[model samples]
Target: MPRRHLHVTGAAEAPLRAALRALRTELAVPDAFPLQVLVEAEHAAKAPRLPSYDATDLPLFTIDPPTSTDLDQAMHLSRRPGSGSASGAGPGGYRVRYAIADVAAFVTPGSALDAEAHRRVSTLYFPDGKVPLHPACLSEGAASLLPAHTCPAVLWTLDLDADGRTESVDVRRALVRSRAKLNYAGVQKEIDAGTAEEPLALLKEIGQLRERLEVERGGISLTIPEQEITEHADGETGGGTYELTYRAPLPADGWNAQISLLTGMAAADLMLAHGNGVLRTLPAAPDGAVGRLRRTAEALRIDWPHHVSYARLIRSLDPHDPRHAAFLQECTTLLRGAHYTPFRDGDLPTITTHSAVAAPYTHCTAPLRRLVDRYASEICLAAVAGTPTPDWVLAAFDTLPDEMTEGGRRAGRVERECVDLVEAALLRDRVGEVFEGFVVDVEDVEDVEDANEDQPVTGTVQLESPAVVGRVTGTPGTPLPLGERLRVRLTQSEPGAAKVRFVPVVPVDPVDPA
Candidate 1:
């Protein structure tokens, strides 16, 4: 999925904030945790424990958005000689040390904090703010993997071969301190300028190697440019105005993601080996779906050779192209029916693989931001150490799927509605103006009240300017060609109702072949 952000200026912030609040109410998101939960959070902030290992000396660092405060995982990647006799006796390999915030340590089992977390399931984010699962005192303060702050963490040490294949895994609770807080753009700049320091210098090499391994394992990664709405002061009008642009992912972002992916795969392996734990599962795409996508590609004029895999073919696409963007949008049909599967008491999950990763995977990396990661981390730690899985975690395993699913759907609704509101607001004053756009999707509209009994055609169009996508009425006789560029005139835009509509403006000359 592509990332999105809405930056509203002071003038436009009030209405957007109100919409977000209304969305929270409509979604039934828990506004606040119970009083008892807050008390527990206060107490947990002061409690301390000694871990078996003090890894504060490790030159670990966190990379995230500049505004992020609830840091979850910090990492240090290096190449070193293998140790010991059984497994670590070879030449130097990659050593990946990932430190995940120990959220379980702060939220006690069967307590109000735990119960509230279960209710919330995951953090719900919006343009203005987020409704966090854990109290700020812990998630943003105590349990966060902040720089120069020694915090308890569930540390994962992965020993990988030269080709980035996992050779061994170790998980344990430890004390860690992040040396620095890094952001993607800055790190990418440093890397491009050849000024990247230790722990980040090897990121590209290791990340590319792991990417190769992923491709070899039949994994797929989509890299679509994200569309974001940013508000800025209008010099002429002296008021706030919004602008939309595409934000491409940096190389550092991909490299950092591989670290988290490595940890999740390791966590899944531990749980699956023990025949107990939660797995993020996605069935392989059906052959029919792939065939449909191939047809879509053909319609969009994208060459799909028989020799190339879908993953590789898609990766080769230029996201900036309208046809490529339409094809990528169509590819979403292939990645459907993802769900969490939990197994226990020697019972094996019928489905264990996450199709995107081409491996058994689970969530255990972002405990500070996600509720499931906390439970998954506890399960992985217990499974790796040959200790019994915590009773509370086991009890919640069966119900987590439902909770997470509901929360995910609600979050999706909130995101879509917010985007709709922004798009509507941006175009409300421009009704009847012509704009260039490409048809991305087509649909047939049936109206029984029509005396002529003729069905109307409608579809979605991605406008060239403003980067807005909205529904558009198509030509009556001719079906709108998907991925074809055209001129459209806005017919309706209601900011308060979060609605926008357009109508095709047929050209006087023949339409160019798409």
Candidate 2:
């Protein structure tokens, strides 16, 4: 799904903030870092001398959202002559230099800062604000790879063949500076207008090449548009409300992601070869999963030819179509049981591959915002330098998996609940009105205790307007088929419970085959 942004105005703003605060309390998230941690951060920011190599002359730049402050990574991509090519100056391949914030360099192994970071695991973001994993003094200040400032970074230098395959990798700590701060929309505009320069200009060509390689490796990319809720206020009426909208990711986003993916793949290779590191792993989708999706496509009247690959078939669908939306939702069943696995001393990990990436992968970027990335970066640095891994990082491997898993579950619940609350608030005043929606998912009533007591079936419906998806009741006599478009009347909406319910208003007619 695409990213969702929520905006609320006037009267609705206060309540939404209050609700988010309560949700934070319910989730037991720390509102602020410990005082000792803040003091440590301040000291680290003030101290200048540290063990780092200087590479500040490189012209690097950062690309992210316009309002983003916790900048983590910067890049500089350029072409160079290949090893065996005829002309030394001719285009042989590409050299990519990616710099990531060196949070580990500032944080002592057993200090309060490290302990607090371990507890938080990752940053939890909300529409109004975010609960940061590290104090702002470092995450957004000294350790951040902001433009024009020399900062410590875990620099990754990768050499790729013309086809975008990795030829060599190097990881080191260096003092680097960014030339400019760029945003996705701005870079994309330049790309479309054919005026993009240097690194941004090379993104499209390299991104396409890497994407083709991904397909050849049997990797799947889900390009679903994300639905977002935002708030707005009216000065004339002295009123405020929330609005929902969809945000489709730009091509620049994919190009930037490929760089991150490339670095992670290199990190995985380093760790696996040395036999001591953590990996992000997922099992291959079961055989029966594809068969079930084919059946779903058949019932939805969508074509799924026997010869088509799953990845190709999904890429061919129009995301705006109701059938495609429902199909994409169903595809989630294939990607389950994703988790982190750790190995040591040349002991091969039982699960080494992330099925989604179709390659061995790990998390080594974004140390400013993620806990495991710090450890992963340290391990990679040691592996590349041919030195013994740090004892502290090795000791941390035993506990990080459980901490990260629990924190991830809590963060996911908070995000989903916040969206549900805002959606209910947006629809509360419109009860008893009919709207057009498509049945995205359905379930047979197992018992009478479900939401629809009298109706034999209950299901989820995605509305055309308001961009809301909620539960709806279907008549026992007329079953609601998946992907069927129908009219529904809003029956109830409770913002406090983050609940919404609807009932089918009329039967859906089958499409004519003229």
lDDT by residue (tens digit), candidate 2, 303-415: 88898888888777776677886787678777777788889999887889999889999888788878889999999999999998899988988899898788778777767
Candidate no. 1 TM-score: 0.92
Model 2 lDDT, full chain set: 0.81
Question: How many angstroms is residue 5 displaced in model 1 relative to the true structure, after the best TM-score fit?
Answer: 2.3
Candidate RMSDs in order: 3.4, 3.2
lDDT tens readout by residue for model 1, 3-40: 57665554434555566577677778788878889999
TM-score of each model, in listed order: 0.92, 0.92
